[model samples]
Target: MTVALSLGATANLGHAQNTLNVATWGGAYGQSQEAAIFEPFAKETGVSIDTVTYDGRLAKLKTMLNDDGTVVDVIDVSADALNTLCKQGLLETIDASALGAGPDGSAAKEDFLPGALSPCGVASVAWSTAIAFDRKAFPKGAPTAISALLDTAGFPGIRALPNNARYSLELALLADGVPPENVYRELATPEGADRAFAALDKITGAVRLWNKAQQAITWLVEDDVVMAASYSGRLFRAAAGDRNIDILWDGQIYDFDAWAIPKSSDNKKDALRFIRFATVPARLADQAELTAYGPMRKSAFPLVGKHPVINVEMLEFLSTAPQNFQKALKFDAAWWRGNGAALQKRFAAWRARVNAARTDREAARKAKEAAEKEADKAAP
Candidate 1:
């Protein structure tokens, strides 16, 4: 049986709208969240739900939304894309009052964590950037700090890091002796770029850059690399599967995942109801438990206490515990939206340069081998 909230006088039960189109990533998190929360909510409210998964949500929004106005009525977006959507006027501003306002006729926005609520969206989950390592490789204790990953001399192992400029620049800055608070400010200018690149160059030969979550995790499990910076949720999945992996929250970047309603959605009322229902503390907690992502609702904390993310007692063994959210940087999505194309060109060129170097080295090796063979034959 499907469980749903009552559409009494407070809810607009008369409309009988039976459908909502939701957009989210298609993964463990996506599937579980949809099944546990969205599906149940639909059953309860009589609002049927459909899903669309896009690997790159910002790009997806651009493609799916023709600017004729309406696109998917509801979207779950990362903080980075959420910022971009807000600027592009692609999202609808949420009214807290209508969303079960706070006491004394005021809205209940305070129940959520700071910065979780937005004019156009509200946070659905919190994910952190953290280190995942092979526990079997280091049974005594996992390296507990981000700085530890950068210390090639002390912690000898192949490391995999993300190729994205947003988090990469911050990690480079952090490794280069720039404090977390000063990372973005320094990188905001040209000089900061020079410093960050110089720092990154030191570890270039030791690091393998990865574009996907699974690649990074696989590198750790396959013993291809000993340590990697990866999405926390991915690590959770890996650990759940008994990969002998452990995560360290040291210097991990935390980001909020938000749920937004399109301003142009024809089903505005249904969309709002869906958002409200999906975000209810208990329902959101269920999603968090199944997916191992952090819940945005303060009320869900109790429900999520048993989840790995909220396992305070075992936190010392976790990767994200040492992560300083205060020092961790937030990606400037608006800046990226404007400059992404140019930056992508630069990254592509950089990758090509690396490939070219490898190609040249291989060609030289072949020539050397041919010369050695010719000299031996002539001597004989």
Candidate 2:
């Protein structure tokens, strides 16, 4: 008997067995990963898979959960979004036991990173948020630590910071000499956020906030800004494009993108099957190669040296060196899920204040230039 699905479900419950839909963040990376791995799986399993873009995924998932018969099945999101979905009961718990099959018909769990094979989601890719500087612009070595980026007195140049409060604030605190391990605990209080903001205030005059990834990449490439805290993937692209950019692996923040099955799906088994195939080491490696993202599977590390996406030599300079990997502050997705909204409000207010100050400075400078020009004309 065919498995009974919720009425009006999007799952093809007919002769077409493996057809499914996947929701992912849109970009060249998404398209490449889909074509390389997900599309191939569709052909192998006789499934016709469709891919759609869902940016700002957490808010989208919440809307889908509230409405029944939502079409989304498999979703690719940041670790923070995954945790938020899991906590909101928007994602189905996955059973990895069913996915293991090998030469000896054993589970593939051993091939992946420990704690990564979660019941609700699995970290599919690893990438770093690091300090990237244009070598020609700075000429000196890239800023080594977060503190170095924060040090305007020594390193005087315009810098880019993400508009997001959580990670940005964490970096600010880290630059202020807050021990990495103590960052999260300290960020829990208003006083802590104040300190982070105050530290950031020192560089406020020198900062340009980048809200979108593409904008950040363009900024780095055009030398619009000398140095920006950006994703490792973007840095790879910049380096590959012959831009004289170097990444400071010291104090780099690492984050993961995870695959999750939404709880509102009509076909849990099919979703799990797709996720399993997607997470397979070979497939994961291919996706990483196509997307320039690092693979989460431990077995995929060796493949890293071969991929054009990674800077193999730069890997030696990683802040995530085995000893320091644990030292980097892991994003607290749970806190983000609970307090993200409020924090965003606070961040917006702060940003507005910064913008106003910048506007005033620019207006004053323009006024002074106009006055100087008028005086020169009158004297002549």
lDDT of each: 0.69, 0.70
> Which window of ten consecutive residues has the lowest lDDT sum in model 1?
314-323
Tens digit per residue, CA lDDT, model 2, 1-380: 11122333334455235556677777777776766666677556656666667775567767765674557777888887777678777788876776644334456676566556776897787777777777786555556666877888777777888988967887888889898778877777888878988888888777778888667778878877777887777776676665487766656667788888887775677788887887776776666666556666655544444444444443333333343354466667777667678667878887887787778878998999999999999994
TM-scores for the candidates: 0.75, 0.76
Runs off by more than 4 Å, candidate 1 = 1-16, 52-71, 100-107, 136-141, 305-327, 337-380
> Model 2: how far is 197 from its true place, Å?
2.3
Residue 338 local lDDT, model 2: 70
Model number with the top lDDT: 2
Q: How many steric overlaps does candidate 1 have?
A: 10
Worst 10-residue stretch by lDDT in candidate 2? 1-10
Residue 343 shift from truth in candidate 1, angstroms: 6.2
